[model samples]
Target: MSAMKEYALGVCYAHPKEMYDLYDLLCGWEIAERAVEMEIVERFGGDTYPSKDMFEIMQGIADILENIPDEEALVMLKMVSLITDKPDLMEEELSFWRGRCAA
Candidate 1:
């Protein structure tokens, strides 16, 4: 399974009855993921972006819309869109991913 899927499964398992909490956890994960992506970009000093992954994640969240509800998914989608739209953020994430790939 993908890292995101694994994380989601873990969240579901950990909070089976707390759907709202699961949503919160997913949002938190996205925030942290974006932050790391930004830091990575600054660290690598690269101009390349990782928009594909951002979009993939956005789609993933969208896929969960039925389970999460439109309102909640919209909020998550907005966050994902904000991150994807920012070039600086994309660079940061790519820089980080590049480093990880190199390592």
Candidate 2:
């Protein structure tokens, strides 16, 4: 299974524990869910610049997605869009992810 899927399904921590959680989960500073962090960026407006924390999450997301195969990442984004109320946000993120896809 892909790292993202494994993380999503609680199958395992595919990356280093620090990669999964920048702080609190490690440094006991701020523990935030990846999904919630994604929504934070969306709530702040996709076009607007991200705040520091949001940017951190965005970077983290990029690192996470990097571990996934391009096709799998696209499909995963599509699947997530179907179940999310914020399908548009997912689509927008998917577009961004597609651009960043390594292959």
Point to the candidate with the largest TM-score.
2
Taking the tens digit of each residue's C-alpha lDDT, what string does model 1 give over 20-92? 3223323434443553344234333555344665545434443444465443433433333345545566456
What tens digits encode model 2's per-residue C-alpha lDDT throughout 1-103?
A: 9886665534222222322332212122132333434633444435445568756655664555566655444444334434344444544544543443322
Candidate 1, which segments miss by more than 4 Å at Cα?
A: 1-61, 87-103
lDDT per model vs. reference: 0.42, 0.42
Query: What residue runs in model 2 are displaced by over 4 Å at the alpha carbon?
Result: 1-48, 81-103
The 10 consecutive residues of candidate 1 with the worst lDDT sum are 16-25
Backbone clash tally (model 2): 2
